[model samples]
Target: MSRFGDPEWGRRRGGRLTPPEGLGVLTALIGKQLRARLGSPAAPPARPDLDLALPDSRLVQDALDHCAAECAPDIVAHSIRCYAWGVLLADLRDIRFDREALATAALLHDIELGRTERRDRFACLCFACAGAEGARIFLEARAASPDRVTRVCDAIARHLNPDVPLKPYAESHLLNAAAALDVVGAGARALDPADRARVLATWPRGDFRRTMQAAMRREQAAAPNTRAGLLMQLGFGGLIARAPFGDTL
Candidate 1:
């Protein structure tokens, strides 16, 4: 078995690794992900002309307002970035989703990080139900959908696992991308400039824009399709380029 632990160990051991290197392994895996996969377009944005049914941008603006009022300014900024990325990922993947709900959920996923005094606690709570209350608070304030709210909560709960495999067709890929982005940006000490650049190249802006435009052209070449379906294709392509394990993770 790999030193990181066996793939099935998580299931057999209640998702806990033997010797508790599980946490360190998880941190290292996320570091490798950040070094290798973060920022690669997991999908393409919808055609420029497609009108997404996202809640008015004002909802995000309002969440930002409320977050700033109640949480630390750093938290507010991180929340905004997560929301923006979540919405973008949803848009790129063509997932028939409530954009407003996704953004609100993503933004608040880490709200409890503000409360944990220790790093391990912060990391642990970030992946457990401890943060659910905070996420619920954020979603409730905006009157978001309960189902979407639950999904966001679930994503937060699983954001840190080193052993859990991503559901192949689910939106978990986007959530994984977001979590790794943050960890790599902040905690990946082993990563150097060369490594970051190599990873970033996986989703180079020029390639993303070109691939997205091409996907749009292909979709429009046939009968028009729903905005969400098109985004889903884009997201799939992006994930193909940056997913943690080429064929497995």
Candidate 2:
């Protein structure tokens, strides 16, 4: 297995398209493209939270340390950058959310990615559910409150769902937006360009395109009926290639 933990990860797979399972994702994605292309506001949204760092609680540090140890280096960096991007998106919309939940969820969202082992339920599970369960176990072991544990796991589980509502699921909604921005540059223009540049400079992408592409394929292969598979059917490789970020910052 590669350091990424999958042997097939080096090979290209999705040679034939499966026509999306339905038109809902397609419609949502098209709407996303249009929204991303829309004109920027005359003035940027006021977001003092953009200056704040990731939550400093012990739970947050535990999450960062565990994720860094469990996942690939670039994947960990991507997760941290996901937190920053999600924070920016939350501030852009003035979404009231728990920073601790958001921070822990963002950092742990992809911790179970690239699992083709099928050696256990977690490895065999769908993309989002697997990671969410892993997070659930981690938080539960630490005696996290039931509500906080639910919040983090739910956010991680729904991070791949592009159309998650913002009213009560701000954590999930922001995570999805952040992941899309980092992976495909889908909504990069929604935030201030300077802040975007800063986020990248801090946690620069490093061969992320290659690793993330391979990871997505690993998930699709492990669970072809999942949203991961749906993303591939929707031309995910093309999206990754088209992302604005290069192999480095």
Candidate 3:
């Protein structure tokens, strides 16, 4: 058994789950355990390379659980990985940010994708914008501080527009970069190899590449005149083809 209590935490083989494979899996399992423990008051010593202090508030956990419940398994996994990558990048870049705000933004960024009724709004506006609006409503209902709600909503709104500047907020910039890295492996080369390996091992992309492609296609079909549709028309094929991970799609 792995340190995280399940040796088969992220293993897939022969179209069925399997036992953990290598030392990388063990390392990632341990890393996940450490992060979970950090959510407690008497957490273990922090790693010098990165601050693993994630949001432990009841609201934060509720948001995470809500996202997981509403989204597909692959998308939930993607959101969690985005949070991990965003914080790691923030640490590496020496960027100062609100840890809870960043965590909230990362975990709920693509939430609109999980809502079927939002298709009409998404047809007119970008999914990111729709998702941002949804996030804002949810946060406000939860009584999150006005400043935190704004920051998280803003980060979610701009996460898709990599070309636009994410300035004045490290959380937004890191979230954008992190999503890009996860989606198409953009900017992934800049991350430490070991760290990248551990993140992937812990989350295990599964069928994310194909799932993401299908989601984008659906978005395009619904909103062919929107930014997502325009991007899909322009070079989405090339982007998917260039993704570093296995293209099972």
Best model number under lDDT: 2
Q: State which candidate has the highest TM-score.
A: 2
Computed on alpha carbons, the lDDT of every model, listed in order, comes to: 0.43, 0.75, 0.67
Stretches of model 3 off by over 4 angstroms after superposition? 1-53, 114-117, 121-124, 164-166, 247-249
Compose the digit string of candidate 1's lDDT tens values, residues 91-168. Answer: 454555545555555555555442434324322222233454556566677676777566666565554444334343
| C-alpha TM-score for every candidate | 0.46, 0.85, 0.74
Q: Candidate 1 — what's its lDDT? A: 0.43
Tens digits of per-residue lDDT for model 2 on 1-249?
311101121112211113452356678778877876786564375454456478889999999999989889999999999999888887777788888889999899888788657426653355566677778889999999998887787788767765677745578778878888899987777777778878888898988999989988887776666667778878997899889877885
For model 2, the stretches where C-alpha displacement exceeds 4 angstroms are 1-22, 39-49
Q: What is the alpha-carbon lDDT of model 2 when measured against the actual structure?
A: 0.75
Off by over 4 Å in 1: 1-54, 57-62, 90-96, 117-128, 137-144, 162-172, 182-249
Distance from true location, Cα of 30 in model 3, Å:
40
Q: Write the number of the candidate with greater lDDT, choosing between 2 and 3.
A: 2
